[model samples]
Target: MPRISRSEAEQNQADRAGPEFLEALARGLRVIQSFDRDRRQLSLSDVAKQVDLPRASVRRTLHTLVQLGFAETDGKLFRLTPRVLTLAGAYLLSNPIASILQPAIDRLSAEINASCSTAVLDGDDVVMIVHASPSRILPLSAQVGFRIPAFASSLGRVLLADLDDAGLDAFLARIQPHKLTEQTIVDKKQLWQAILKARADGYSLADQEVEVGFRSISVALKRLDGRTIAALNIGIHTERGTPEMMRQTFLPKLRSLASELQQQLI
Candidate 1:
């Protein structure tokens, strides 16, 4: 028998536990996410080590990914190409919530004079779907396909807060929080507590984790059936709004907008 590494072991466990529709795709995404801005280029061994797959399995998967145009290699090193954007792009383009939420997001930005956006949870990150900034001057440069970890962004926490206890617990267990800045809550216990508070309060605030001197607040959008599908948020410089001001002024408007979208969704 061959040794099963941690990722392989996790995959096998998921294969047994999850519905048949999920396993392979989940494993493939794990491979794609293993590469990032810092480790843009990787060797076979590097990919295997990062994703915790066996070297042979990683090689085969990397080759498949390369052939699919999602990954590229120069024989010595492999990297993700722009084609990987299709994975996120396709989701954003096809998701109904994004379509319905875009005009609302645009209007919200115009009304508040801040950048507004809609994002959805993808694995452990929030993928930006629709973004509207008040002025081209205060640019919302995190484009539609940008992704950020759930533990560190207001958009992320708003989506996570909508999860049921079991789903939320699973998500929290998977997150490996790191200090993105002095304000980041890297401790799992504190992060979980914060999420609980977000759930109870019906919104979330992220203070300078995604970027220094910038902060955001978000509220989740749900269907009539009570399923959370996406989140709406506003990001601005700390000078514009403190977390308290966000909750007081913008939070109700966000909730109202999300409610209006939910009526359309159902």
Candidate 2:
């Protein structure tokens, strides 16, 4: 057995993407996404390995990003600059839901004294589009762009419950879930059942799934025409509330927030 170089692996991926694929643009975007919260600054080789591209290709992309002010290098490792935020800002500026929902979510967070957020599914992950927290420090370092695995998150399961049978099957097939915590559900059939339960109950409460002692509950945000477009969620530690308390106390508030947002969305 032979080990293929990173360049070969990337090229293979590009080849399967069809002739219309701009490998350079794909490579550049992959390079940008490779730098995340945990891997904020990476050397050229590190990024190359992460994105499965050649060091030379990654180097060129990094240099282009630096010249364009999207990234900066300390002569050893490359890190994304604040300008990269403009990319996300552009999306937020175009999407009025974030603005329409932020203030209300802020008020809701203050009222509940908890972290509240709304997220929409993107690919295999759920991306938070709006978030608010109490003035004090937060237990989870989540923001507007924070992402979590769909199978293990309360918000993600609520959003997933909106999918029809075929769509849900497709999503389940695409995901290769691993247990994040002892309580996380990694089996596809069980995950499907969980999403179905959320649909039946109109809400979800996930206990100690993503992190130890953390609990998150969510409700689906539907449009006037009954399309579930997003999920509204509140995250807390188990010390603050048990699963039953969360369902009894937090679920109604989350539902009210979602209802308010739905009225404004259309």
Candidate 3:
């Protein structure tokens, strides 16, 4: 019989104990995530270090991924294959929400000549699901599938504001806010107050919180039932306007777009 790898052994134990989890699958997914823009190509040792998995487990996971055509190896270096995009493609194809929002975001970006994105809260971060940018006057941190800390993002605050008290408390308990910039509100009490303000105002803004000289304003995207499912935001260079100027010029448009998006869900 072939030798069972550590991941396989763990999976066997998990299966025997219960059916709620699959350790093998989890490890394989972690291997996939180990490759990103900054670490696009990695050797076996690099992947092992990044995922904190034993060399044997990482090798097995990489082999499985290569066999599935989701990754490729050039003898020594391993990189994700274009086939991996199928995963994102499948998600976009199956989800009408992404399709519905893309056109609107495109139009908005063109009209304002700025970047627009829609994100959903995931764990302690906000994951950008759709992004549209007309120009690159300033660098932006958001892109499709990109994740940013929720504690310091306008999109994050707008989505966080939708949580009920118990849910909000649970989130606050779990997330350790870190200061990303001079303007980042890392204090728990101060962050909670910001969320409360967003909840009352139905929108949120961040100035140099995620990055210096970048500003954003976000409004919640809701369902017909009035539950916020995601957030939509416009990203602008700080040189374009001050915070108050941004609100005065763009808030109405953002609110109108949010309402239009909500109506589409109905």
Candidate 4:
């Protein structure tokens, strides 16, 4: 018999897993998530490095993704195909929230001449569920379905602020935050304070923590029932304004857009 691979051994052990736990399915999704805005294409080794799986396991996953029409490869490198959008499209089409906000989001981004987006907190990350950018795309431009760390932006802070004390504490305990930029907040105490301040002020502003020369301000989007369901934010280049200028000039515009959405999102 040939030597079985490390991931193969792991998969074989899935037979012992709980009835509801689908180990193979979980690993498949992790392999898919390893491709993102920063990593559009990857080799077998690159994927193994990302998902921390054996190359043999990564190879199997990649070929499976290819057969499913979710990904494609040119012998050496693999990239997700447009067919992958079908997965995201299903959510966008089914979720009334995404559809309700997209047109307004586009208008807001155009009005601000910047990128505007909405996000919801999921685990340790904030997923950008809807987005629009009127200006040229930058290295940091986010689109629909972008998942960024919850601690990295104003948009995330608003969502985090909506959490109760127990929920916030639970999030803090599990997250292993790292610096995304020089200004990124890696300290737990500071992150806690930022979230508290967002709760008190009804908004949060982050300056260049997610990317250099970028700033964002966010306000929570409350439904008619007064639940803070998501957050709305606008991305601006630092040259566009100082922090104070962002407050004086752009914050109200962002808030106004949120207010209009609140009326219909009920």
lDDT of each: 0.83, 0.88, 0.89, 0.86
Pick out the ten consecutive residues of candidate 2 with the lowest summed lDDT: 1-10
Q: Which runs of model 4 end up more than 4 angstroms from their true locations?
A: 1-18, 54-56, 137-139
TM-score per candidate, in order?
0.79, 0.91, 0.89, 0.87
Best by lDDT: 3
lDDT of 2 by residue, 1-266 (tens): 23434366666886898788876787789899998989999999999899876667788899999999999999999999999989999999998888888899899899989988889999999999999988783756357888899999998999988889999999999899998899999999999999999989999989989889789999998889888888888998789988999989998898888877788887
Clash counts for the predictions, in order = 0, 0, 0, 0
- Best TM-score among the predictions, by candidate number: 2
Q: Please state every model's RMSD to the true fold in angstroms.
A: 3.7, 3.5, 3.1, 3.4
Residue-level lDDT of model 4, residues 103-222, one tens digit each, is 998887777678888898887888888988865745364677878899878988999998899999999998998999999999999999999999999889999999898888899999
Question: Candidate 1 lDDT, tens digit per residue, 184-232?
Answer: 8888888889889998988998889887888888988889988888888
- Screening candidate 3 with a backbone cut-off below 3 angstroms (N, C-alpha, C), the clashing residue pairs are none
| Native-to-model Cα distance after best TM-score fit, residue 184 in candidate 4, in Å | 1.4
Residue 169, model 1, lDDT? 86
